[model samples]
Target: MCYYLKLKYFTLHGPLPGMPPQFLLGNLAQSGLLFDKASLPEAHIAFKQRYGDIYQFWISSTRLIVVNNLNDIQHIFTHRNIYDQGDIYVQKFSIVIPHGLISSKGAKYKRHAGLTLPLFRRGKIVSNFDLIVDCVDKLLIRWRTKSPQHVHLDIVQQSQNLLLAIFGLIGFDYDMETLDNDNDTNKNELTKALQYFLSNFNIMLFSPKILSTIYFKLSSQYRQSQKTIEQYFDRMIKQELDNGKELIAQRKRTSLIASLVGSLQQDEEMETNKSEEDRKGLSRNELLDEMRLFLLAGFETTSTALAWFIHLMSKHPQVQQNIKTELSNNNSQGLLSLDRLDSLVYLDCVIKEVFRFCPPINGTVRTLTVDDRLPETGAQLFRGDQILIPFHSLARDTRYWSIDPELFYPERFLGADKDHHPYALIPFGGGHRQCIGQDLARFELKVIAARLMQYVTFGDGGNQVNSGGHLSKLTIIPKHVGVTIDFDK
Candidate 1:
């Protein structure tokens, strides 16, 4: 029956323009095999060779159109109404993240985005700069202790800790200080939850929710850990509410949640002048869900990006040294102030290059709300078509980037020539729905990378980090990224 269904689906679509579709399973098996172990860039290049620039593939009954060109990405993102985040992965993300920006869509997403945008404004991000620097300082101190030895540092753990500290300051006004105090329960629990989420990516993909529920019931530790995260947030929210009146009166610290609660309180006060429906604010459950989304979204992507940056730097010694030299000239004290870090041009290039090289979110899946045709290829796509824009592939495409696309060249982003195709390097994405925390992420990466370079020199640890393969998860991550950090001076 399954075989017959596969044949029927492929037979209906006779190679819709760019490339021919396979008789059975379409190009799904081939695409899956390429992505199974190779990096996103390699997979994209391989597919482009076999199935033109844009190709269609089917995984069982689901059909996907992979787009590797900048023009195509612009078309999809700009025509926001036409393309929405529609994928099985997004559905799964909703299960864990609830109604956060990453999972939410349409008017609901827009409204929430409106309410939350102010919290991540430049002024607000600048206010949180000190907290970011403090986190980086703590990380450097740890690296200093392991001086002169090849420290088998888990880049992933370090990145997670850094982001946790940043998010704690911004979200709950809590200083995690996980880097300094390894035994912090709040830090440990959050870390465990994230790690567990990543580790069980495949299970979440294949296992049905009912089966997952049964498995969670059987696994006492998973149940306990999940409960810990829920209880922690619940207590934190309650405590904030309890202190809400006093907090508003004093206006001591500025947190995203505080900003939100403050805004809602003001709306309530002005309720008499507004319509009944307009006066309604986010419910307690809604607030908690939003908080969960902010925490996970803010931390995971930034941490993952940093891990890749460190791994890449270790591979390219010349680029690492250039960053080190640039840092020395700017901040001789090795203290990374946000202002000083911003002045390091070479360091900024390195971060941008790393992002371009290995985008944390490799590709985003969008579904066409209405029928549309590509301007360049004139390929017609119907409503409900799933489009995969491989950001990793576009960044490295030889057609776009004239240099050896595979090589890690920070100079590609340096002065004068900084204006490459805008859509070409879309690590944070493009259009209205670009990453809200991009500036914050950039700040965190700059400070962390600069401070680390100041204190240590990362050397190749015999084996290359396996930063590829098919992880049944939201983000593309390194399978087992091992690095050796050597302390300097």
Candidate 2:
């Protein structure tokens, strides 16, 4: 026998004790189907009934071990060394976009995350509430004009514009005001790039490697769109570098890019006193990478979450009414401020519940770094083995959440229930590798949701809202949604 045969004999000696494979597509046919129409709750229900809490599934040729039990999730997240960040999908993304925090793994991830973390410190986020409120006010102004008309608003577009405005203000100190203009090129290109990235999710279901390669090569439009995105940032970064001194002198600025560039420059100056060997600062490309990630990951994920929140609110009118009443009773003027947003318990519950109902990233894959057996299942997994955790399925598992897993109930997230198992609700993920932008994203959602509720009354736009056939490259997003926005005016 060849060396390959010897390795197979050593590694794949016996059948794993879990759900039997489904010939070709494996459990993916039942679980990994298109997101837009896929009933994640139903899929989890079926899996729980058939294969128990822990089961084995396959997507393409890759084997996935799904875990619904909270203990399993805690074990997986806490043991970061054993479960290193998965590189299969990140490697594919690096081909099309520059690798940054989201794609970088291991020590590189650690270093970049450290550098980026200080920028999003709680104080900075609190200080920047006005910038967020400003963007929301612009959106509210636009909504007021369309109110009472029962406009069939492309909510996805609206949310994208609102997020882009926030990104522009913070990322580059460029006030996009995209909501004012419907045909802005920069806004359009950003939206298109996000859509392309979203499409990559399902494209992975078919043949990720081949499709990704083809997408980078044959799709000239996508390539150009990406280039446009890069160029836009490049110009903004260049402008900042050119005017850095003046901006720095202007004190008390809230822009994220301003803070980053200032921090880098300060680090560079401080490095001058140290030995050349010890001096380390971000290069031009590194700065761009950080900015790109902030714009792309920051805006895209927040926009998608906000869109889903609105859609869910529309479907559940009572929840919307409760939210409205809560806001009405409270002073709407100061509610958008960070202090007030932090105090809004019900608002926080609603946002958390939205995440439970529809997590932006359905699942994350991690490759095993050491040969080990799953604690609960006792199944042997070798180094280089890939494990998939489907958050979409886990969040709605009836075993963990008893209150009609599919329903949108914010109360389930409040009070004592808030202290439920860590893994039970992982919208922002768990452990050290959790999303870096969680706090910022949550703040953005609360500020936006609170402000919008103050001015507009969301209603079912006479169209069924479903997260079917949803695609995800980096984050999960609704495909195409049309909702009616009725203004409170």
**Model 2 clashing residue pairs (backbone):** 36-467, 36-468, 36-469, 36-470, 37-468, 37-469, 201-472
Provide the overall lDDT of each model, using Cα atoms, as 2-decimal numbers.
0.69, 0.67
List the RMSD of every prediction in angstroms: 4.5, 4.7
lDDT for each residue of candidate 2 in 1-489, tens digit (9 for 90 to 100): 645633432222245535544434445565655443444434555676677766665554445666666776677888888888766556555655444666677655665565567656566676667888888888776666664645445776678778988878766777655776653334565567656655554554434456557766787876776687677777776767777567744532455565556546445456557653454555455566677678877787899899888878777888888877777666755344555667677888899898887788767767778987777766677787766677887777777775777777899877546676668888877766677788888888888888887777767665554433354545666655656777775
State the displacement of the C-alpha of residue 176, model 1, in Å, after optimal TM-score superposition: 3.5
For model 1 the TM-score comes to 0.84
What lDDT is obtained when candidate 2 is compared to the true structure?
0.67
Which residue pairs in candidate 1 have backbone atoms (N, alpha carbon, C) closer than 3 angstroms, thus clashing?
A: none
Stretches off by above 4 angstroms in model 2 are 1-14, 17-49, 147-153, 183-187, 204-206, 245-279, 330-336, 463-474
What overall lDDT, based on C-alpha atoms, would model 1 receive against the true structure? 0.69
